[model samples]
Target chain A: MNFSSPLTPTPVAIVVGASSGIGEAVARKLAHEGYAVALVARRADRLRALCAELNARPGAAHAVAYPHDVTHFDEIPALFQTILRDLGRLNVMVYASGIMLPSGFSEYNFGKDRATLEVNVLGAMAWLGQAATYFEQAGEGHLVGISSVAGDRGRVSNPAYHTSKAALSTYLESLRNRLTRKGVHVLTVKPGYVDTDLLKAVARPFWVVSPEQAAADIWRAMRRGKQQIYTLSRWGLVMWVVRHMPSFIFRRLRF
Target chain B: MASFPSADRLALLTNFGHSIGSVAYVYRPTHAEQIAELYRSAAGTGFTVGMRGAGRSYGDASLNGGHVALDLQRMNRILDWNPGTGVIRVEPGVTIGQLWAYTLEDGWWPPVVPGTMFPTLGGCLAMNIHGKNNYVAGPIGEHVAQFTALLPTGEEVACSPTQNADLFHSLIGGLGVLGVFTSITLQLKHIYSGNLKGYAWASPNLRQMMDEMESLKADSDYLVGWVDGTWGGSGLGRGQVHRAHYFAPGEDPSPAQSLRVEAQVLPDTFFGLVPKSILWQFMRFFMNTPGAWLTNTAKYVHARTLDHRHHFLQSLVAFNFLLDYVPNWEKSYGRGGLIQYQSFIPRAAAAEAFADLLKLTQRRGLPTYLGVLKRHRPDKFLLSHAVDGFSLAMDFKVTGGNRPALQRLTDDMSRIVLDAGGRFYFAKDSTLTREVVAESLGPDTLARFCAMKARCDPQSLLQTELYRRVFGSI
Candidate 1:
């Protein structure tokens, strides 16, 4: 039993897109681990409800709700400073704010693709860019961006979503390369099909994992200082096979 | 990543005057060992710790902003008390209110107290606070017999006037930059009764007021003047003076009852009618310039016509802790808060310097609402703000529109004060610049103080916003 003294400071973590899914589960896990968690998402009601629930647990660290839309790129800098001021300091930041829209195989709406790219790729850059600057100056911090295994290859199912994930993964990798020498860790999380709202459109998704399981995997990888990870571990083998396949043969595959 | 597993929650802390504020990681350590542990943890980390006691300063003296605030309020304990010899040893967190409440029944009182009794003894020593009797007894540091402290380097040492004399004098006024005070031993004043003979009189102007205070210093134990900052021209610096004297050995007929602890507790109501807690709400209506002028005029008129040359007996608490009479009275200044600008000018230059300052305020249409006048004699502390002169403290209400103007005004006032060979008090400052502090303390004294800081805290881990603002990485 490790009882904390009254003078002990609980580490602070900020979880974007914490209104639901992987971000929400990660917030809960961090709170349970005695980390003061800041929940940021577009859904104010969901964030408040989650905050209340997390705060109601006895001996849990404090949780605060910050209602924000990640697409509001200009607001991220000020909000980031406000969070640092309110939470005292920042030790970790998780960029899980993303969006995946359903579309027919024959349909190609630029509006849907634009929204998906805005939330998944641009939003992550805007939010994580702040963490990068701060962590670089402070010489110590953790940055996690939740990409996806779908980024391994462009499938016939969704082109924009795959492109966004690929851009996110490449961005995270570049950040990891640049920040490694500065003592800052950047983790690129490529989670397989997780049972979240984003996965509701899929019918009989194979190897589907729960949001809690994915969150546990991300936390473990982050603690172990892994630069990249595949949720459930088995997806590593599957992605490897997919990446090695020739484009001429991959074109014949259907969802 | 480097981690602080023992850090406490984040807090937004403000000064007692509600003037300046900041956010920091606040920690409350119960024992000296915990403070040592904190020092060890923060050794290589980029976090600086500022010591806070009761948070009674009027400015940023206790604020760390973006760092750690080591609040010693929870370390309060009366380690030992010798009522027979009027000596007591206590943890740094013991408040003046607690000390008085515990020893009043034994016919003992703190030798040097501020205008309020809520400040901790540690904070009082840190600022070297003075009282109405400062001219006679000097600041609180003069009454400290000895103290033990833990330096940021994890060195525990004892200091007194004879042992580590330089460290003793510097730490008392170091503004909590060198070390953390663990136990403080002080010599208390022995009294025959809790009641003091009081006398009240009004000075027609600033010159007469200074003369009266100078003449009354020998006969009075405590003398304080309340200046009407709203007055101008012929009536400039006009105010009321209240002098108190302790009772002789056999002066009081009921010394036993008068010395009881219950007799020293301030009443919770105004004349047993209105609850003092709610008076601030009513006072908010008079917080504006016109309202303050009207109120000051009325108070002066009442004092001159009815209470002039009044002689009476008053309790020690009533005479000393007037700032605590109305709880949260600062709230009346509104959310913009208020700041106090106090300057200690040598007697030769006080009358002229104070007159210039008062006239400048009126000319700028920014007169202070309340003004306090006190006589002080020089002390041996390294950072001493006292002189063989008079100190005038003025309170100004802050507003968004007047913030820049207030800063400019303080800058101009600093020039007039510095020209007159005056000093600045850290406890009541918010707008002083590094240049002003450098000129006030001189280079040699500043170098000596910084050398001591480097020796005691080699890593420069103990710091506050005031230190940064005034010293700027010295």
Candidate 2:
């Protein structure tokens, strides 16, 4: 109950897009590990419910809901400070907000692609950029960005989604290189076919894992100080083979 | 005109010593209404406001990292003054230098002042600063007649010893968290002249120094001891004691002339030759361990042989404000800056506890470059650090390589102080834990302070890096 020790205040984490899927699971996991979690998302009702569930657990650490739309770039700076004020100190920030819109196989939809890139890439940059600046100054923190195995190659389906994932992975890699010497750790998580609402249209998805399983793998990688990781372990081999395939042969292939 | 909400701009604010810093959205308000409007704008906005006055705190007390910092320096205004009664009313941003300069000609002086004259009255009251005469005058808060403050809850209230007494006691030492001072009325000390009869003597060791101070407390108006922290063996804690007494009526033949502002201004040159502004550049050459050892030894030897039992007449400005004598002297500590570890221990355990602390720093080869010893008496403030004994402020030079070792040394020192029933001053502190604060304050006092905070700031709108570091977001 005494929070006076600057040497060891309860660790705090901010999980963006924590209303559902891997973000919510990671928030719950972080709270269980004794981190005061700030659940950030656009869904106020879902975040409120999640906060209640996380706060009900018996511990000094709990959850606070910060309903926010990540596309509101101007609000990120103030919101970041507010969360820091409420949580005391920040140790980890997980950018798990992403969206996958349905697109026709043969038709190109700029609207869908634009929305996908806006939520998936731009939002992560705005939020994680703030975290990066804070962590760099403090000399220590953790950053986790959720990418996807779909980014490994130019796939025939969901071009915008794959492009967003590739951009996120590269951005995380650049941050890792920039912050590795500064005591901050950046982790890029590439999960394959997670069973979340984002994948609702996919029928009989291959090697599909539950959201909790994917979150657990990501948490393990973060704890291990990994720069990049693939959920379920087997996806790493699949992605490697998919990436090395000849370009002419890959263009003619279909999933 | 810039409105209260739009006045904010990103800024990096550092403590006076430059030892610690933070980046925040800073807003400088010129009137009380702007502050009140700022609070309204911050209501339910998730960001907390930290009050800053001249940014003189040596640590994070004035820093609000990643939040709003309300700077009050521009609000300075002398609202009222009565030369006969020696009662002065001023806005919170007025500095000690301005106060003394404005009233010295009238034969009045601030009741209590720190070693530096640049700190604003708001900061002095927030920290309840002490002086060499603390054993007699208590802290500056005791001299306060009344004050008006605006709380984070959008309510302004007047408080004094007889009215809103609880707030009067807590707000003065609250570190500017409970509310922001709008204006303060203070009672100044009546003086006949600006000169003080001074005496200097050397002590063989810690025990002798304390004994001499105890013997001189009744007759002397102000007393301070300078310790050679690098000394060891039988000469450990060896230092010099400087005592001063005010000139009685008619004792000074030229009272009118001595009380003039020109008579008290500190000289800008050394012996009418070398500029004191560049003195820190020369001092930097001797900041290392070997150089410090040599300088400290030479200083002690000089004090012992030449200044032993020295007597002379000294101006009030010369007697105090030694910190301002050497401008940018702290910068000589290098890029890492410096941290002062000051502990107030009860008289019963002062000698042993301070001896252990001095020895611990010596054993680690991190002897303090400067050690100041002062006598203190218990006060009525809620979070008072004063003890009916002694306080030793040790200044340690920090560097990139020795930070880890310095941290360990402070940790060990904190344990010794805690075991001896000592308390810490937030203004001078860079390191302290919640457990230490809770143990020092006890549950009853902590609960009362927290209760007052809740009543005054229901939404927890006021905060600082120091507050969060010591009390968290609770």
Best by DockQ: 2
lDDT per residue, candidate 2, B1-474, as tens digits? 333233136566777766666656789899999999889888877778998998877778998866789999998999999999999999999999999999999999998999999899998999999999999999999999999999988889999999999999999989999999999999999998899889887788998999999998998899999998999889889988999988888988999999999999889999999899999999999888788888888888877887736558889998889898988888988877888889999999999999999999999999998999999999999989899999999988878577667767887899999999998999888777677778878889889989989988988899998897778777
Q: What is the lDDT of residue A250 in candidate 2?
A: 93
Cα lDDT tens digits, model 2, A1-255, are 423232234678999999999899889888888888999999999999999998887654778999999988778876887787666567899999999987678969998898888889999999999888878766778999999998777698889999999999989999999999998999999999888888886656888898899888888998999988898789999989999999999989875
Model 2 pairs whose backbones collide: A4-B434, A5-B434
Q: What is the TM-score of each candidate against the true structure?
A: 0.70, 0.78
The lowest-lDDT stretch of 10 consecutive residues in candidate 1 chain B is: B1-10
Which parts of model 1 have CA positions greater than 4 angstroms off?
Answer: A1-255, B5-8, B308-310
Give the CAPRI rating of model 2: incorrect
Name model 2 segments beyond 4 Å from true. Answer: A1-81, A89-106, A128-255, B1-10, B44-46, B152-155, B253-258, B269-291, B364-366, B398-412, B447-451, B454-460, B468-474
lDDT of residue A173 for candidate 2 = 90
